[model samples]
Target: MVNISEKDIQLLQEQVISLHKEAVEGNAKAVKDLHQLLERVRSDHSDIPLLDAYHGSTMILIARDKTNPLDKLRWSKSGLKLLDGAVSSAPQNIMVRLLRGKAAYKLPEKHFHRARTAIEDYTFLIKRQIHGEGFLNTKRYWQLIYELGEVYHRIGRNQDASICWLKLKNEAQDPSFLHLLQLKLKLLEGKPSVEYIPDAESPISNLIRRAANATESELNNRLKQQKK
Candidate 1:
């Protein structure tokens, strides 16, 4: 590991802060600035663990918003190459693969396997939490999970999509919300939410409501007859 002086790190910190602001604001200029920061990181603090991660994530964003997906792929590969060269130096480097897989997935749907692998790596990294940086903030694991699921769905893989949604659905941890989400998915896929009511908003939801109301009244009538 290359040692960087505190003074140099402090200098880099200021630039990184400004670059972060630019990133949040969606400034077109931020991409160039982030590239410049990565260059500085490589030059000044070659083995610092955080630098490659930050660079990898920024490169993923660049790949995501590029006017041409093909051109973005080249930049994405370049970022990954940089990470690959130093991956041994930064042994627990989930961000690099995660970013690369996300880029590859964007470039082509056939690359879903790559995205899946990246997600797996990230999950392990999150569990480890090797650094103080909270893994959830550092990575978009859930978003990628959803995206991967959607990609599978696009390829007519309902079963695979269901796999992802079931995990996501279970994560909600509320039975009511879980049922709502399940019902929503049923609506999305043009399936029935329940035996009596079809899945739909507005008119269909209303129809379901009316059906329930009628059933409630029927139960009340039965109760009244029994009471008599």
Candidate 2:
């Protein structure tokens, strides 16, 4: 494993934050500069999984600026592959897992396996937060919970989504998050609180339903075992 000084790590983190802000604001020159800084970090710490993941994320932003469809596809695929490798290599690293999960969640539906991977990571993170592990009171923790709720909502797990939102509503003090949680709760209130039952006529949907049910059953069984 490549080791980095604390100062270097802090600098990398700051640059990454700047990179994200610039990417969001479409500041091409700033994004380019930050991307170069990330590249230098990767070169210096070639074996660092976290840096690798961050580099991959930066690549995605770079891809957004590509004019050619093929170039865009190439960049996106390379970035995602790097992220996937980093996550696989450091499966227990919460930060790496969160990065991979969030990136995977934003990917297109054709990457179905990535969606499942994201869900698993988010579930593990949420469980960790619930058990008082790590920095549970931080902004990142709250944002992770909110993102998990959004993922659940996207994946047709309305009940799970509602549970996440309700938890956030009760514990969150940040006005921005609290306001969003309230809206989510209000939207979910009148809707059915049950698991989504897919149409039996669609084989693909039925398969998904069956798989979800099996996963839920396995999780419940594990929880029961842990309690014993």
Candidate 3:
């Protein structure tokens, strides 16, 4: 195993913070600085797999969620196009395809098929656990599954969409996602469950429960108000 010191982690953190500031401010120098920082880290810890994953993940923010439009590259296909092609060759191809889907959302409606394909590839990667493919958080997995279901539903593939939603409901331990899933299931079953938002609270599980309760309350309120 390669030895990494606390000092190294601190240095990486500092670099990431600086890059974020520069990225937000649309500072061209910060863009160059990020490249330099990445190169420096690569030079020292060339063999670390996790570092590559971190970098790939960071690329998602830089390429998609960066604050400054001026700082944004014309950004075609997730800006994997802008970064070193070598960075694209991380342990697994999951991040690459996921990023492609993120970018695909901004593309023209005509490109939806491509977007769906990209998301499917990432989902497959997750299912196969390729390249450390992730569903680390239940919410993230369910979100993707629901999105996949949405696309499927649009294409009138009701069965495939149902499968996606069912898998999502099962994977989501968070009651909010699960509760939402139940409603979706009911609707698909011809019951038409109403939409609801759980109330916000501390701790993830409680927060989800609150969200579910909030939804029921909302429905009751709507029914009450409707008589006016």
Candidate 4:
């Protein structure tokens, strides 16, 4: 068996984050590259649940890129299974939860019934942030709130969604996020928010890009061995 070193794992993690960032940006080549890199990881360290989570996320990406319905369903289910296994193995692992939560959020809740999974993961992480126990920064915390609110809205929890959006409106510092939140809240209230155009790109796209945010520095920081 090949023994993967700590440094090697860190490098792999960095590559995974970098590749995933590109993949999220509609880069087809990057998606292919990510698949190859993850295949190598799976071959050498299939036992590592964190790596499995990454592989699972890549599978979801692949599924999204597929045009055939059967292929999409197959990949999505396989990816979800891997994500479920990883979470089952390390329920408290922040990265595992984040990957699975994001994947679950992207999935069609009507078909997968994974809204509850997304809600649970985001809620768990948010509670950790509240207790100052997790590594989520302000940006990610707010993003999670937005995603959680979205899931709530999908599941007919408008009041819960409003609470989340209101918290961001009251406390978040990012102007772009604030703009998007206002529109979302207005729309939720059955108001004509779309009539008020912003000075830049579409706020909905901004929110999607922000939700897909990933960076090597952020991943490196999160992947560090915390001092216990």
- Relative to the true structure, candidate 3 reaches a TM of 0.44
Candidate 2 residue-wise lDDT, 78-152, digit = tens: 888888889888987877777677666654333233557677888888778778787455666766676667667
Better of 1 and 2 by TM-score: 2
Q: After superposition, how far is residue 72 of candidate 3 from its true place, in Å?
A: 8.0
Full-model lDDT, candidate 3: 0.49
Q: Which stretches of candidate 3 lie over 4 Å from their true place?
A: 1-73, 77-94, 105-113, 129-135, 154-156, 171-173, 182-228
For each candidate in the order shown, give its overall lDDT on alpha carbons. Answer: 0.52, 0.66, 0.49, 0.76
- In model 1, which range of ten residues has the least summed lDDT? 193-202
Q: What is the lDDT of residue 176 in candidate 3?
A: 59
Best by TM-score: 4
Per-residue lDDT over 1-228 for candidate 4, one digit per residue giving the tens place of the 0 to 100 score: 599889988988898899888886567888889888888768877888988998888888887777665666678789999999999999989999999998888875545667789999999999989998859777778778988987777766777888999998999876766777888788688633233313222332232223322322342232231110
Lowest summed-lDDT stretch of 10 residues in model 3?
192-201
Clash counts for all predictions: 0, 0, 6, 0
For candidate 2, give the lDDT of residue 5.
83
Whose lDDT is higher: candidate 3's or candidate 4's? 4
